[model samples]
Target: MNHDGHAKNSRTAYTHLLWWFLFAQGGVIAAILVPIHVLVQGILGPLGIVRVVDRHYDTWIRIVGNPIVKLYLLVLIAVPFFHFAHRLRYLLVDLGVPAARSVPAQVIFYGGAVVITAVTIWVLLTTVPISFG
Candidate 1:
């Protein structure tokens, strides 16, 4: 039926849009984080003539423990988890699961991802101690 065909087309379009949106989001994060990470690890720390690993370890922990940085980390973790869940759903479909099966699998996968992300964000925000000293 034309209605059925249209519904399928709409679903396909939505799926494609979701993929592109997530992909672009990830690309933007990578563009920002990669350069910052490299600069901190490669250029600035080394220019200071300090051991890179020691500097990186200390700096990374401090950055992760900072409130603003932790917030960014939460966003980073959450987006990647959602992206992973979506990709896993497609993998399930490719493995020959029926669409009905795949839908529920996707739901459960994302639900778990959300719960984990929440817990991680909470722990990052609370468990880590911050000092201006």
Candidate 2:
């Protein structure tokens, strides 16, 4: 039916739009972070202020502790998890998984991603000490 075709088209379009938006956002974040990250590492390396081995742990703590950084991290985690889950669902469906099984698999994948995101946010919020308070 024409109506069914149109509805399916619309849903596909919307899903594509969502994927593009997330990809754009992730790309922008990467663009901004990559330069700053490189600059910081370069500066530290020359001054011998931080070695490569030490930098890994130090950078992790510093970023996780900052509120803005933590917010970006949360976004990064959530968007990628959902995006991958959606892609995985499509793959499973394409590989001949029944619609019934695929639907539940998709649901479980999304649910797990949500749970992991919540746990990550909670851990970051509680463990990081706020300097302003």
Query: Best by TM-score, which number?
Result: 1
lDDT per residue as tens, model 2, 32-108: 55575566667766578766533566555665677887787677665566655666676777898767255477568
Error of 2 at 7 (Å): 15
Clashes found in each candidate (C-alpha, N, C closer than 3 A):
0, 0
- TM-score of each predicted structure versus truth: 0.55, 0.55
In candidate 1, list every pair of residues with a backbone clash: none
Least lDDT summed over 10 consecutive residues: which range in candidate 2?
51-60
The lDDT values for all models are: 0.67, 0.65
How far residue 14's Cα lies from its native spot in candidate 1, in Å, is 12
Per-residue lDDT tens digits of candidate 1, residues 71-96?
A: 77677666666666666677877888
**RMSD list, candidates in order:** 6.0, 6.2
